[model samples]
Target: MSNPADLGVSSLVLQTAEGGDINPVYLGIFVVYLLLVLAIGAWAYLETDDVNDFWVYGKRLGPWLATWSYVANFVSAVSVIGFIGAVYGDGYSIMTGIIFGLMLGVSGLYFVVHKVRELNHVTFPDIIAELTGTEVARPIAGFVLLANAWVYLIMQLVGAGLLVTVITGVPYEYMIWVIGGVFILYTVLGGLVSVAWTDLVQGTLMVATVAVALVYITLDLGGIVTINQQFAALDSGYVAPLGDGTYTGLAVLASIVAFFGTIFTSQATIIRINATDSIRTAKIHLAAAGVILAVFYTMLIMLGAGTTVALTDAGLTVDNVDMAFPVLITEYVPTTIGTVIIVAILSGILSTTDTRLHACGVTTARDIYDYFTGGEASDEKLMRVSRLSTIGFGIAATAIAVNPPGTIIGLYEWRAVLLTSALLIPVYVALYSRDTPGKAVLLSIILGTAFGPGWEAFGAPFGAPPTFMGVGMALIGLTIGHLVLKGQKETPAETAVGND
Candidate 1:
């Protein structure tokens, strides 16, 4: 085990180590995890009866469980693959950006969670409609949320398909179809109940797996000091405060802005807060989730940095930087433990996919359908449409996953821009400021939406990233629109409506 030569593929092949073959162990752990997930789904289904139960667990979830579920939902394919890939490529600067960015997101909860809990809405679009006093806002918010959720879901499915192909030699196409189909079935069968419960379990396992892997990797590298020394020997930049020119000052600032703006407005994260039992619970959960996310992401960055040193020194080429963490685990850890890490990674992907799909379905039904139809739709009818929409969206995501349009990280960042621009201002005003006029709020959303896509198409000048530009335009529009509208004379009926 002390042999450095034993760490590479060539040496392992010569030793005829059982560690190389992951099929049986991977399949076994997956089966167990699947069974546990399905069982939880079934339990949740038995506990739920109405649409509220299906969508928000009847708003009865406790602090700890809700907190765990929220944290799990937030840490998606981005945490596992995107963050690790960034660390491997750019080093500690990426980690610094993420830590500060995440703290900004957590602070956003303080501004909005209590108000969101007060609304008592079952869906994100419902909150929008309530805030803006316009039916149109619901569908617009729904579209933005749907776009973000769909893109994120596809990213998770694609990651799962890739992981399966790498570990089991399955065709990527087949794995995509199989993984997507299973997720759709489980999600549609149990809805939010299934997603939440499964997330809780996956979240626990993932934390344990990452902690164990960190300890094991540290020991294998001859402890923390040796690991740091080795990293410095390779590239002192790895441990530096700022990245090695890979990410610029503007890019880092843009990242922080996007993180804060999106987390405050993103339907996926906000809806989790609304799903909790009470305002106190929501706040507690948000604080706890913040801490958990900070630790989990920091561990991932460290693992990525460590594995980069270990692999590079052994003359290995990490073609897919996203796989660096798993590759290191399998190469260095005992076979049984390695299997657990692989399953944990797969669990991360599946947890994210399941929650995203559920959000998409709920948004389509509640935000789009109920709004247009004047909330007259029967729960049965809406549920039927929701299930069908989930399948349709799942298929579309699978297609996109099969042929990704850009780097997964780029796709995610762009989606965040779109979401932040479109919904951030309106959502914040709705939660905190009662004076925000409905007309002004609607105008802000429209302007913000335009600004994001507009800046991207026009190539933002002043070296401003689209995320910053869009958010800036949104805030400006919001402030000016409200002032202009406030100066105008109000009709007697309009005055009455405002007072009400």
Candidate 2:
């Protein structure tokens, strides 16, 4: 699952009149896009020769391919749909969370991320194990990766199923199977090679479609000045810096911490960094993706405000924020462009879903499985295991998606908290503080999960985002472990990532 698009935190539903005829155009676009993606999977099967190719696409990534894959894998309905939905409620404050938090994560990453490339690793666990010099790092980081990927997969599947169900008028239950089955199939057959190339296609279309939607909305509502006036007319705070205080400063700060965790530690990031052909390409691609995301998100402001104005003029009000953009598309936008928006939304979801699902495969075959193998697993044998694991996790995630757990934001939070709380700092430490004891790394992870997600599970007693406490404790654990465990233990040897 790419993202529930948490677009703010709900399934996207485009409301229509009773007995509305299903649009053949949407069905055609959706079907054609899926076939093309599946075909890429088939081709990648040929490109993949061993586990090395399966995991990091043979490290042959260039600037454009990496840039497209990077952005597409990160963007989901949440960015296009959920974010626009967020604008409906919080207004400009939401922009700070997206623009400031994510942009900083990407831009700041440029400084230190090259070292990640230099590591010559495969999955996230590989890096952690290498940097921490501990065997325990693999299983611990592996489990967290699965947890993150599992929840994230369900998030994308639900969003994707809803998209197909609503657009094609397929039952949600049936759409879940169709969408879930196909993503699992492609991911297993192709691995990162297929995933990366498909992301390029998905990413380009995602940007173009949203850009079109934002442009149409802007013109239809007579531009940003007119859109601002319309929203200001709705409420002065809509144009105010804070946007009605739906999300306070504390909330924004917490979100940034959450964003940082995901950026620093997620498998999606590790593979992208390592997959690059050169460190320079990784830097350039990441910088480019950052700028593109900035522009794309800035357009979300217009998509939200402009759509509000357009939909209001049409005498429609969507109580569900997730429905706002979809309603805007079906009712206000031209038919051709509307179909493109629907297709892109689904494509965006799959683009992200495939990336996350691939992470699950890495966690299983590379992370957990490798621990048992002790770095001696044959390349062909490990490749088979990766494929088997991909299929297994895909089926599991799809089954869960058919009956997803919790609300959208709650589900997406699991994806963030586990990795962010546990691995974010450890990842950086491994990069910069290589001398930090293995015990310190392990404790940082343990306390981070305890304070972040463990705290969240207990209802977050402090009434703040879990990242605040989780990361706080993570830092404490790191410092304490360093002071206590330093020189008391001999660090384990660094085992090279075997399949590579």
Candidate 3:
């Protein structure tokens, strides 16, 4: 039997055939990418002179730039490493997964963004505090946001380390330190202004790089028809309908709900929505981001399918799904071109890393420290704390990345479950229905978070998937809590204000 790695690598080699190890060239490209990012960061630092500038870019981002940055922020290490790996394992069902998630996300945004705008909040915790009118919600939401950001930051850091290790023949540990150090500096110094601008550049490069790779892979595999035939031959589950027995109608519905719910609740997603200058810009940017993400994820799914076919034809099976793109780039593309792809991967990883780090800092300072301390903290003090907290979290994430507990896909899934189950319901209520009682919101968050993770740890009564169990319980808990709280009486005047 051919080694899976050999099969994948051999196919890549066959495509390029440009002699010589291209690691040096790849390293050079990576240097250039890093330099470009640094330049953007430096420029942003010059433009930013206050805490608002640091945390929210003074809420001045326009539609196009904000839209691209939003898309880029949403598509991080997971889009390339985790999502593609998912397709490699699950086949065309992955495309359905992407579509279902995207559609719901877009719909959820329409409702959520308007509410977020009304609150005039900068971070996720700000929206939570506005809705609950309780200081507790701010700190809790901040902690959750910080945790989610840290988990995502680790993923991005790991992806960056992996790229550097692969390109420079360096140890993963060293690469982690190097990437972490650079990210901390840029993020602390430049803040959101730097992160957003860099994201714009990196996002464009990432899309272009993926497009080129997809085109090359499609042509190599004799186009879409042949690709579909190959997948069809692999498994009947590859192209089944949403209600098909493979994943079940209920599960599909739950997945869609979870996707929509998560995006609506997610601080990362909402922060981007809040970052836009106006409601009109937010709407336009949200729509544009949805379209861009749909296109990018669709192409990724196609690329994954194509890669699966190519590998199978060569008598290989991928064990490490995250390796799919890297294997292809190194083996199939010309050395010089392959180097560019590597740089693109690095760009994606760095853009995400910096954004998440900045988010962690700002969320911690604003949501936790400033909230509990009676909001008396000066911007300079908050900014200092934010920067320090960012460094602290970066260290923690680097530690986790150095000793990852599971596969990249598994880590991403766990992070998604954690963030979606606990925070999604509360976020949605806060954004859409102002009448949702503070007690209900708090209960929903506690129950959803507890049940979501609990169900994952202990098996469900039936043989339900963990994700379904978590999200289902979260929704049920939120509904019950909301209804229970809704029964409480209020004066006619109070009711009218709540209704609005």
lDDT values for all models? 0.73, 0.77, 0.71
Give the better candidate number (2 or 3) by TM-score.
Answer: 2
Residues 62-146 of candidate 1: C-alpha lDDT, one tens digit per residue: 9888877887787777777666766676677766665577678787676667887877777777777666666677787788889
Candidate 2, which segments miss by more than 4 Å at Cα?
A: 1-21, 491-499
Q: Looking at candidate 1, what is the lDDT of residue 105?
A: 79
> TM-scores of all models?
0.90, 0.93, 0.88
As a whole number from 0 to 100, the lDDT of residue 246 in candidate 2 is: 61
Residues 1-500, candidate 2: write the lDDT tens digits.
12223333333332321214566777787788889989999999888887778888888899999999999987875676666766776566666665576777787788887888787777778878777778778888888778888888887887777666666666667777788888888888888999999999998888888788777777777888998888888767667665566656786788777876687777888888998999999899999998888887777677788877787788987665656776776667888778878866876889999998888887788788878887677778788888888888888888877666653455765667777888888668757988888778888888887778888778778587788888888989999989998876553354334435
| Winning candidate number (TM-score) | 2
Between candidates 2 and 3, the lDDT winner: 2
Predict model 3's lDDT versus the native.
0.71
Clashes of each: 0, 11, 3
Report how far off residue 96 is in candidate 1 (Å): 2.6
Cα deviation at 125, candidate 2, in Å, is: 1.4
Worst 10 residues of 1 by lDDT: 1-10
